[model samples]
Target: MSTTSPRRLHLNVNILHSGFVPSAWRLAHADPRAFVDVAHYVRVAQIAEAAKFDAVFLADNASIADQIDFRPITALEPTVLLASIAAATSHIGVIGTASTSYNEPYNIARRFATLDHVSGGRAGWNVVTTADLGSARNFGRDAVPVHAERYACADEFTSVVKALWNSWEDDAFVGDKTAGRFIDTSKVHPIEHRGEWFSVAGALNLPRSPQGHPVLIQAGGSADGRDLAARHAEAVFSASQSFDESASYARDLKSRAAAYGRGPNAIRVLPGLTTIIGATEADALRRRDELIDLIPWSYSLTRLAGTLGVPADTLKLDERLPDNLPLPGGGNGNHTFFHATLAQARTHGYTARQLIRALAGGGGHRVIVGTPEQIADDIEHWFNGGAADGFNLMPDALPDGLQDFVDGVVPILRRRGLFRSDYDGSTLREHFGLQRPVNPHARMETPVVAA
Candidate 1:
């Protein structure tokens, strides 16, 4: 082993519609019905592990949206998919998205803890607030809650989850055969959390997870979102279209973290990335055009309208966006993607057709098209250039696209010492080199309000 620790690169494969390309499913080789199939997801996760990736992450939404008619949605519950993934692979970390807004803390706490145990500590929870009026409707609400209140609920929600995770001390499990004892009951405590949003009466039903608590990840970029991440989140999934914007976001978030008595390194920001791979520059361009050509113009228009909160019929493909475009009313929709898409259009002064073509299937994440070597080069440039700490890889097509990334780009990354060649530890936290979180009681001071 080298005495000097290598500069590790964290790569997470994000399973999006066979792959990240908007028309990936429409490809002749792509499976249109794969989204609901558990085995399809498991096979993808297995490929990621074989490539030595840090984890396979699944994004989620609680309700069906307008785009479901045109494209597949992530309809499976993340915990369920991750459990299946855990069974199929032993070393890869499984990260699942769960909306704090719609879920109860106690249930979430127990669910993730069980996942961690089942996966041998290779589980992580991506905390999100399902931000769409459509989701609210499914939950029997007329409208989405405001940003501030949603975050307030998230803050209280995560607190309860953490407390429940710590209810059982490390030594609480004492399976002594001779003594006929299974556990030390006194070591297990109840968390009586009565907060403005939720109340949890007591301890989690399961024992403490192998990694203490599954890693807490957050992915909102609003002001309120950053504050919550600073105080609690270990990793954050972000979206920024340009390098300058990404650096600014990274700097601002890390700087803001200091106010919470946490250091800049306390939180890691990984931006969403969609890559289209080819053998050469010309090949890459051809490949991208192929994917774009597969998208139905009507589907793109409807999706764009919903994102901009505009009526679909009013948006003409050939026309420029009307001046003084309205901001989304009600805190509905995926805020990061909502903002990023608008920013992309505004930056390039794009017409409706241009914008639709550019976004094709990315949904709002940054999209990069290049050869395999070029793809690795772009990732290295961003990682070292302060644009990101790591990337959440969204392949443009399912198994084929991901396979190309793994077989071609992974070796380049290893050769350049940008990524790992083998497993370092069993748990997701260990793979990320993060320390197990110490319980809050050990660090609690009198709660101080933001001035």
Candidate 2:
């Protein structure tokens, strides 16, 4: 609460296959093969970049977590796909998800560092702990680790990555042809790190990146998750359905970051938002219904049951969620989404079928169906009300859904002075108004002892 003018909003479009809805691929205009098409992704990114969006995010899972029979899965590797996007677009940031649970710290560090260079410092890493047993099994584990253990590993993983990124000083490369010196040997240092999770003798293969370190992002809602984010994350993709809940979460996260000696604005909380836009309210509702109608009840039920850790048959389409439903393993495996789904059910008394429609783009995040004016109002409310720094937008369909929002809502935001009308900076850090991190090992002073 600095009582200052509000910070400009930030938005990133999550390009989820064809779209957020399960049946988006079946839309008359959507290409069923878009999920595997690099051109499809590039087209979407170009659209977002043209609109002055801050970034385009791609979420990943090690296994086929979704019901692939009905919908397209998140198939391509994020970093590789983002490289193609980077070559196509100039300003928009490219963020890709990589799990701390399954991947080595060294490889993760090199991958993102390389991407940062390829994108000219417009790369971001969304740190996630793989929660599903399917992903664990794919990585050779029979079961997912307990909540606390996963976070412990993540803590170490992130630390090692940051250390490796700092191994080479920004000025390490002198490249003087007359002296035949390509690098300043004295300026390079090894991070000699050995920890429970990772061990690295560093001095990264590449020099320091343009943005120092690519922006670090996190998406989790459990106590451990929030603590990790407060300690390290520069941005958080949240799952909150209501304004009050989102606002409360923002305050708590900012306070936690402050306690860790970070500024109040250190972490930007961006809740997931699904928008189904139309020229009229009726038109929007009709489109939402059309998408919902295409999704089978069995698919929605099974999906919900998986998150709840209960039998699909146990849930009735017309009945309320069981009051005695137990929290999954003391709140593990998508803790944020499980609780958010429950909150929506209990607060609004939505029957299972109604709940499915309410969460047409799968649940957990908030959904808005309206004309551009109404959508703009909702976005303004969240940004001005301290409920969010911005949003991780998941449009109903790719290209088309994103096109509508960009053409419709973006102009409104620009008119109201709520968003930028043009690109203001070249790097992701500059776009988000984040400071580039200084290399901890670059310049240091030795302590003097008094005798």
Candidate 3:
């Protein structure tokens, strides 16, 4: 779309506990403790790295957002867990989520900068604003911050983090024995930032990270979210359900980025895709049915109700969704997921039961059940048709589902020249074809003249 060839496809695996499905833990091969075990995550990372995938992503929540009795929750602290993952895998990127709603800018800046150095530049931060009241309670608040206020805080929070990242020049470090110097004091400056949400007056203790600031990623789909991504995000992980929907979203997002003086190529829009692969289309469908059948109707209905912001009893399993359902929490509660769910139900006129099956694996991402060729075709269609740059793949089950994709689907994609056969670069930025950002302060000074 930005005069760049749209031939290469970038992919990342979203390591969702056992897998994306609620019943994934029930699978014969699934380790019930995979959610908490470091070995489980490291194994998944190794698989993705072996496949030459761009990255392996870890999504986080400050509070339990799902019914944990039935499914394993995201239990580990992401940055800490990803540090172990970084050590286990050498090429794949390690990206983890952290919320701006509850963290101070300085702490987040230092944490991610440390991750970048630890991972040899194969680190990324998924910026999110915690939206659930459960998380608010954990932070000693009675209610979640209003949507606008949260975004405002996030806007300022990200700005301060960037400023802190830029506080030290690239060559600020100088370890010289003869000169007896460790750092060039003149090359580092305190940020001295003051904003609505936070105020700080100091440079970061850490030097510039390997990838400048570790690729900034955002996942909100509201207008405010789009604006934030337009202004700051290098890549967006979106929840889009259809080709038309994703294409439109991509167009609108790029336009907004252009309005902010960023190039169309500057922001990559990768929609979420959940794949249930098998030897044939029918086998794939059977696998989908097996997973859906394992989930209790009560759990499914309750999950759907939560997304729709309605009581569980209000929904009838056999009936279509209520006409003109109101936006969840008056458009404040999980807006992206809410809209995506509604679109899927309304577009297909799916009954409640059908809708649950459709979303059983991915929440609201596009779900495809097919053989390797069919799955490859779906990915190619989206990539070439401008619906997505690539995808953040959520396999229906962990290691096994991912293995099926890598052994079956990935080879087809590679044979078609749509994906890489091997890693060409070591850093995540290089994997995504993005430039390592230059420090803004480095270009501001002119050489002093000796008269």
Candidate 4:
């Protein structure tokens, strides 16, 4: 028998509106208004916490980027919704997406830092760049910024955010009655950051958060995106349909992180996995079919076209995707989803109709339809094989679908010694087996403040 300890798998349930399936809200049991309901999110989070899942994540959008006429888009501001989730549940970490494109470094830094404090260190920020013209217009831009420019801004934005997070030493706060000093001014230093995109004056107004810094999580799959993740993100939410793809992604990302002087295992890779479960294989297949059948062909086609960055009219339902399709919007469209969607279609020679079915009603993530045992096996294989550190699960439907997994798959994982049966730590960092960041400013005797 091997004496080495078993690898611990992480699981974070993405509290996507309704579910991963666009038609999920139309289900008899689902509430169409759940996207805006704080209670719905709270309840979903509670379920995850009960099962000892590592975290509960929220994907955000600045504008209505989905087929809002037929489905619920990601409407609620993630940090606010996640704050509600944190209040209701005690154990699950709350990670929310906030784009660097529209917001300033200081505000984003302070918002998440405050969230970290409020959640007792269970908050994480999923860094993203706005790639849609709709979102750009929301921020008063007629068009999206170039891809390289966005990533460059993200790198600097992240750097400045980090510097601010570390500006105040851990012991900066010293409330001693005798000394009559609430804080040591010397311990708090200014970041004094000036970059191509942003210029910020000294230290943040607040001290460092409970996790030292809330865990930095990112979700991007392009070359530039990977470099951003490797340089700054502690964990990455990936979109890989197959084990080989995920393995290749993990290897490349870790190597990039290593080049930045971080450990090879520094970044945890968690791919998106949408689950549609049933007691039997046939039942699961039927469930998937039902969900697919519920969605209008028009909705799926438009959504698929959007992912591919092509016009809906460009695709014929029965034909394969056109070869050598250039990057959309003159190569400024969302590169990650574009490539991922194209790969799935090309690999299987799936026509537009078949691709729609394969993507589970036209989204760009891996979908699985199976019994609890079958799902567990897939999860186990990925975790043990180093293809993924864990998964950001998107169930077919909310509450019920998530509840099914907790009841069925979690038990199997525990039995196999692949997942945690209970909470071993309270902070998000602990849940992911990461350490709290040390305040680099502490090492310096004095830090300069920008005038």
Candidate 5:
């Protein structure tokens, strides 16, 4: 909402294995084995860096959440892969998803802090709470935590990690050989925190990270999720099927952030966007149809049913979705994708088959099919309309699909002066036009000798 400076759009690519389309791995040029290939992710990151993208994001899963028999899964661990990516690319920031529901705060704090150090401050942590049954079973739990319980823990978990990050003041490390002092002990403070979900006595193991705290990102659409994002997230990955929905979400989130004593611009709302590009509208339509057609009707129907929390048997390809669908897992499963997918179906009154095609054989996120000019125009309209700060792009396919976007749409955005053409700073914070947080502990304890 601040008008002192020209608004700049931010972009991050969700390196979703082969692509957003489920059948993208079937593409002739795509490597079917790319899901676990480190080189593949590195290649995508390098291309994004070339396009001057703000970051390349990776979504994580503790267990194989997808139907891996028919498709590739998110196989590699995020932070480790991101470290490899950071080694391969210089400018593009690396953001990785880690679930707060399962992880202890200290380890996450240490892991990302190390990434920021090695990447020269180009790291972000996307905090998510695991919601699926497989992940729960893998973690030795019989059932997924209730929606409120998971978010409550996540809120506390994030706060504890932040406190640990702030435990050491910026000037805590001092290598004064003459003074025989390797550290300014007084500058390091312990956060003696005891809370319902976590307890830690601490100063972090490492010095303050390059960006103070690596950029905090969150993704969720439920009320608890929104409150968590408003309370702690620096940026959010969102799912809304339409521009008006995205605008409404943005306003609500910013309002919540304001209520928490944060500035309206404190949190960036980035909706999930899937693009299927071609030389023209007809060409793009052909490609979308081709990809969707590759997917078996069974797979799309099953996926849709899962998101809607309905039995796959209940879905008929030619029939419209059943009315009065309940929230997945008794209101505890993923709310973002569920709502987004349902909104798309209801808004268009699409049958199961139509819904599947609209979503490109997968579930959730908005899909755009067209030429570079059209994609650029849509992105412009959303950004200029305050519908989104930008998008977390999931192209129809990877490396190749991203190449199309960078080579095509990026130039148009650059021409309009809506996005950056080159890296202006080494840190992710600088890339996003965000400021490094001042350590509250440092500020509070700075002695004021009477002037």
Candidate 6:
């Protein structure tokens, strides 16, 4: 194995239904029942773990989100599902999405802390300010909060959550059976947070997690989104359709983080990548075409319309896109994808139909259809060419696709000295080469008392 100084590639499987393909469930051998089956999810998580993947991510929504009637919805709540996944797997990191817009800081803190403890520090939370207006009605509001307001609330929300995580110092818990003392009461304090959006009493009910706090992750590529990520996120999940866009995004994110008094390397900017792998290039292309064919043209057109803020009826399959469409009114929605799609369309002079085909499977995320070697080449090129630090892998199909990666691409990466063959540590922090967070009270240093 070749030893490298910059370290190996980090791969995380984004478990979105069967995979990144919109019609993944429609595949002949695909299990329709797997959508709700805990065992099916566990099986996929195991596959990812066997590949020594850094994490298994689950994107979530607050309420009945999107076209739930037609699409396969996110059925299980993320935390609960991650907990089940934690029980089934030992080492793979469990990352779950939670919306800052709908959840309170205290609840989020407790849920993630509990996950970390259960997973032995293999936990991460993908912090998001939810976008859909449907979620608002469920939360007793008629409309979703404006973009800036949601992020403003998120900033304070995350701060309070971190404070709560630090409520009990690392050494606070002592299982002293003889003295009948369970925990050091002096070491625990309430956060007493009173912010514009939320107020919460301090002191998380759970003890400090194995990693102190589960890794904080953020997604969304708007200006406010980037700002929030710079201040608090350890990882930022992004979507870009091309190397040029991904590289630009990486440069901007790192620079923004540096300006925030954090090291540029503090955050890992991983763009989502969906792969359609096959033994040969032609085979992969055929597989990709099959999935694309299954997508309803009407469904695809409607989605593109919503994302581009253009009327669906106005766009023609072969007609070139019009210049300068209006942006989403609330400054939200998938802005990253919006910009990326526009850039792609303008760069290639693609007709509306071509744009739909390109983005049909994975939205604006990069989609690759090739042999394992070809896929590896693309990943290496992106890593070395400044497009990304790592990649969020969304396979075209689950179980089988992941297996192909573990069995095929992983060995190629290992041979090229681009990935680790064996795990180096237990915690996600160790896996990511990040330092363990020091306890807040440790820096304060009260004198230790012996009981």
Native-vs-model 6 lDDT? Answer: 0.85
Which RMSD values do the candidates have, in order?
4.7, 2.8, 2.3, 4.0, 1.8, 3.1
- Against the reference, the lDDT scores of all candidates come to 0.85, 0.92, 0.91, 0.91, 0.93, 0.85
Q: Which 10 residues in a row give candidate 6 its minimum summed lDDT?
A: 62-71
Model 4 regions more than 4 Å off: 1-5, 444-451
Please write out the lDDT profile of model 5 over residues 1-451, one tens digit for every residue. 7668678899999999999999999988889999999999999999999888999999998998888889999999999999999999888899999998778899999999999999989999999999999999998999999999999999999999999888889988999999899988788888899999888998888999988989999999999999999999999999999999999999999999999999988998899999999999999999999999889888888899899989999999999999999899889899999999999999999999999999998779999999999999999999999999989999999988899999999999999999987888988998888879989876565778998
TM agreement with the true structure for every prediction: 0.94, 0.97, 0.97, 0.97, 0.97, 0.95
Output the number of the lDDT-best candidate. 5
Candidate 2: global Cα-lDDT? Answer: 0.92
Instruction: In angstroms, give how far residue 447 of model 6 lies from its true place.
Output: 13
Clashing pairs in 1: 18-398, 20-395, 21-396, 22-361
lDDT for each residue of candidate 3 in 157-191, tens digit (9 for 90 to 100): 99999999999999999999999999999889899
- Estimate, for each residue in 1-451, the C-alpha lDDT of model 2 and write its tens digit: 5876547999999999999988999999999999999999999999999999999999999999989989899999999999999999999999999999999888999999999999999999999998898998988998899999999999999989988888888899999999999999787888888988788898688988999999999999989999999999999999998999999999999988998999988988999999999999999999999998888889999998887878899999999888878767556678888988888888899999888889884957788999999999999999999999999999998989999999999999999999998877999998888999988767766889899
Q: In terms of TM-score, which candidate is stronger, 1 or 2?
A: 2
Quick one: how many clashes does candidate 3 have?
A: 0
Candidate 5: where is the Cα deviation over 4 Å? 1-3, 444-451
- The worst-scoring run of ten residues by lDDT in candidate 1 lies at 325-334
In model 5, the Cα lDDT at residue 24 comes to 95
Q: Sort by lDDT, best first: what order? A: 5, 2, 4, 3, 1, 6
For model 4, residues 92-136, the per-residue Cα lDDT tens digits are 999999999999999999999999989999999999998999999
| Candidate 1 vs candidate 3, lDDT winner | 3
- Itemize residue pairs with steric clashes in candidate 2: none
Candidate topping TM-score: 5
Candidate 3 local distance difference test against the native: 0.91
